[model samples]
Target: MTKKTVPVKPHRRSTPSPTPRPNPNKPKPGPKTVPVKPHRRKPPK
Candidate 1:
């Protein structure tokens, strides 16, 4: 009777990546605003 031998392989595990964090001190970019004139009105009939 012959005995069969099984080969064992090494298991490799992947490491978790680090998460990116936002800066709290920096100000957020906003849309541009246009200035309006106060005397810019329509004339009455």
Candidate 2:
């Protein structure tokens, strides 16, 4: 009765770094105006 065997090592993953882009002559945000109410619907008999 004799059994001994342990050797397992294989795991290396590190490659993903490239993200930096946000700056293009900042100034673009203007379009939001809604004011007009007129709704009346009720006739069914």
TM-score of every candidate relative to the true structure: 0.22, 0.14
**In TM-score terms, which candidate is top?**
1
Q: Model 2 misses residue 1 by how many Å?
A: 72
Q: Model 1 TM-score?
A: 0.22
lDDT of each: 0.63, 0.57
- Any residue pairs clashing in model 1, and if so which? none
Note each model's CA RMSD in angstroms.
15.7, 12.0
Q: Candidate 2 residues 1-45, lDDT tens each? A: 687685755566555657744865775655744444445445567
- What's the lDDT of the predicted structure labeled candidate 1? 0.63
- What lDDT tens digits, residue by residue, belong to model 1 across residues 1-45? 897786865576555556744776776665644455568656678
lDDT of 2: 0.57
lDDT at 31, model 1: 67
Scored against the true structure, residue 24 in model 1 reaches a CA lDDT of: 60
